[model samples]
Target: MNIKKENDKEDNENVEVFDEILDKSFIESYDPSIIVENQVTTETNYGDFQHLGCYIICVLIIYEFLLLLLMGNITFLIFGAAVPNVIGCIGENKNYTFTENGCIKLYEIQKNESCIPIIENQFESIQSEYNLYCKEAENVKQTSAFLQMFAMMIGATFGGQLSDNFGRVKTIKYSLFFIIICCFLSSYATTIEVFNIYRFLGSIFVGTKSSVLHVLLLEYLPKQHRVWVSTIFSFSPNYIIFSFMAYYTKNWRDLMFVISFIGLIGLILINFVKEPVRWLIQKGKLSKARQSMIFIEKWSGKLTDNMEKKIFDYIEEESFKQEESQRRKKSYTFKHLFVTWKLTSYSLFFGYSALVGCFINYALIFNLEKVSGSIFMNTAYLGLIRWFFNISVGILDYYVKWFGRKTCHTLAMVTIILTLSIVLLNIYFPLQQQYIVRFATLFAISMCSQIFIANSVAQTELFPTSIRNIAVSFQAVFARLGSIVAPFLFGFQSYSLTLPYLIMVTMSIVDLTTIWILIPETKGDKLKDHLPNKDEWIFGKKNRELKLLKKVELEKKYGSRCN
Candidate 1:
């Protein structure tokens, strides 16, 4: 007995020695005090663990950098959709209405004088260069918006699939490379058609970079930080950049060049980004996973030996589960999304909510130029409200479990409805109150946008790993859909500014009703493990049949060898 006991002890010692040499990893994913007394425990040095927090912060910084860049691309619509208002110059003839169609500024080149189309400051846009005005103006702008959204949808659909098939880092690298190329080429386009094409193609690149980039950081972050990341990732707006840069970059070409350059910088910086160890394990790339774990552990600082074993063992078991899943059955496909009950319900409603959210967000942004002050200052205020609210929600989520996600989601919608109603009602009050109402509308927009972000954690949680990429990416699809239609809805301004607000208020009410019925609280659920039998239902697995079939296969394979 002593000999056997010594052998077991020696085996354990050998494993620990191997870990020390190999630098195997574990997480301080939980508080150290929660560990069982029988298990190995480590001293908590807040000073030492600060490095771990800083490392994660570094990851978040890189993540937000990429997100901000892609957001810069996604928000190109804010400018493109504004081209109609900004592109018009004084017509030479003043008789453009007689010959041409509606609302066109005619530039006639008399004798020796040059035909200067619409020149705003020192720069001109593609709309001016192509003379895409009059009846064609709205169509051109709407087409650009639609094409951008359509391309984004395609990129997101595939980006998610590729993130699942390859890895997050790989998807981002390829997508951003394509974006840089398209944007650089678009900058040099002499014609409107070519510029529009490039913009459409470039949006695909940004779409591919969107969901997966955020997911990479998400897998590495803890629960609290995940909310922080989610809020930032979801509420991304490039209005601040536009607000400031517009003062310098009056030329469309220069703007494209600058945006492309940022994308190139992201491509270079991405080299330092490590793929999540969870993804590596799922791919069955254990060697790469081990290396990533080493990076994580080195950053996380000293861990208990037992905790190290526990973390690694958990990873290894999950990897084995992935392999077993593949061997036992065919992988789940997109078709499985609609067939499942709860998933179908959640996806449909969330997608619609996302659609409404995007429309409302863009509708507000498209009208920034019309706001009665310095456009840059107005834009900056919108961005600041979003930031302040982002921090507010993150702090609230971390400190208080006051309301479940469902309740919070409903509350946010109701708040927007109430605030918007006040703004509308303020129209009847004195002129003094009208200014406050305008500010109130901005506040309402910020609150609505924040809810969309704070709820993103539910997206990553509700679906199984099998569908998470597409599930999250799918929300982007609907978001882009809303973006596509927003400018057209803003076209209602040709009738009355209040017309758009009236339509939005009606839509918000519908969205609130749908969300309440279809959505459930995901506030307390554990990430990735909240849903039961996800693997089974996701792959259309029924318990008894799968068990019986597995039993038959196992007996056939092993029975003859045993005999």
Candidate 2:
């Protein structure tokens, strides 16, 4: 209807229609077509919600991750806290007294023994407290470590399933609760068996929470924020800080007591949080999903009394995706990951990259001892560089998107391989001591480790929300295997000083090959934008103009005019 008349003298622009559509009375009439038709064009669409609720929830998740990473690192720190306690074991070897039962080793006795001076610091360690030394020392350490790893594997698999089966928000909250309880108990463990048991149980929740953290971050963040958050969350910069504290405090139990309270931060946030809207919808909890959608509107500063109808319209006409009857019914399990081609490839490449990354990193650490400067300062140098890299990655990720993920990772791996080759050369042909500066060579090698942080962002982008945690968790299992193998590579140092370096170069080449072939360029992709053959309308704001335009034509044909 060209209702404008010559006498009316209209401006060609239709300003009145927008004002009328946006008006309170027009909105209250509840004819969905009025908004639906104009929603395609002529402006003043549904409340202009930004869905900022995701960010609000993501902040809490990030805090949770930071605390968990710090605590995980602390587990290693605490284990080594009482190395000085071995002085007693060294001294006890001198006492060779024969008794009827057995040779009783006595403490504080002046047995004629040559010994290195022991530091008199009052560091109370689990080793000192449990007397895990001499005959059983290696057994104690290896057994306790095995228990934790075994439990962690169980926890990782269980946690993935739990997160997928339950919900991200719920799994995080409940898992953290268990962490607090187990951590507190572990701190007070009075015996070796008790301590190992405590550690094993705590690892379950720790491993579970670890798997859930990245999934939660990606699920709640927008595409842009995910890029930044994924980059930031991928590395733990707090290791140095925890190391300093553990060094000065001289008591691990006290440090652990402090870590237990870390989960309290997440506990507070989880109470008022909403699960990811995509997750809710996928699980068919339509009511809760709609509630979360409204929360998103409110959190994004787009509240409207008319939100009820809008949410319903979104669920019925937009967010709700009904699968075809001919399609196979599938459950959310690890098996789906194998069947999905893109997902399978992503998992394989992600696992391989992580494996090689861990392998190269640990191999560097194991063989780093032969470098010139003080080993402590050299290590501190490495850690500080890594910390700086982690912080800078958030900024670096902006540039990474331009090159594409595959290119970025390939370049990084190649660069590190070159760095390794140079370091190996320096090992055989020692750089002149007077000519070399402090930490110069060490700095070159250490800085290349940033590839792990840079690639971590791409790693997160590779998985879908439905099984993201599963993919990441299982991939980490491979990475853990690499870490285990890395220590053994130190034996290469016995064969040749540069043997580990050669092996690391090989691993880097393998990483580059895997990345080049398997990983798709995930640059500028929204989370899970690579899903294969998605025929259903997913809940996102993009493409709404075309969708609304197509629907409005059907409305007009059906004679459902809002006017």
Q: After superposition, how far is residue 436 of candidate 2 from its true place, in Å?
A: 8.3
* Candidate 1: regions farther than 4 A off: 1-52, 84-125, 128-139, 232-238, 303-307, 319-323, 422-434, 493-499, 529-563
Write one digit per residue (lDDT tens) for candidate 2, span 1-563. Answer: 45656435443223454344446353343344433433454321122332336446556465654455434432453233333222332344553332321212323333565443332223455555554443354345445555665566567677777887788878878877887788788788887788778877887777777666666666666555555555444434444555555556557687677667665665776677678776775566767877777777766666687876767776664332434311433555666566455667777777777778766665445344335444445555655765565555556566555655565566667767776777778777866762243354444444445555445556666666566677777776766566556545755676897887788788778877877677777766655522332212333332233244344446666776554
Residues 239-326, model 1: lDDT tens digits: 5665566556765677778888887778888888887766676566776766666566666664557656755666566566557556
Model 1 scores a C-alpha lDDT of 0.65
Q: Tell me the whole-model lDDT of each prediction, alpha carbons only.
A: 0.65, 0.58
Error of 2 at 377 (Å): 6.8
Backbone steric clashes in candidate 2, count: 0
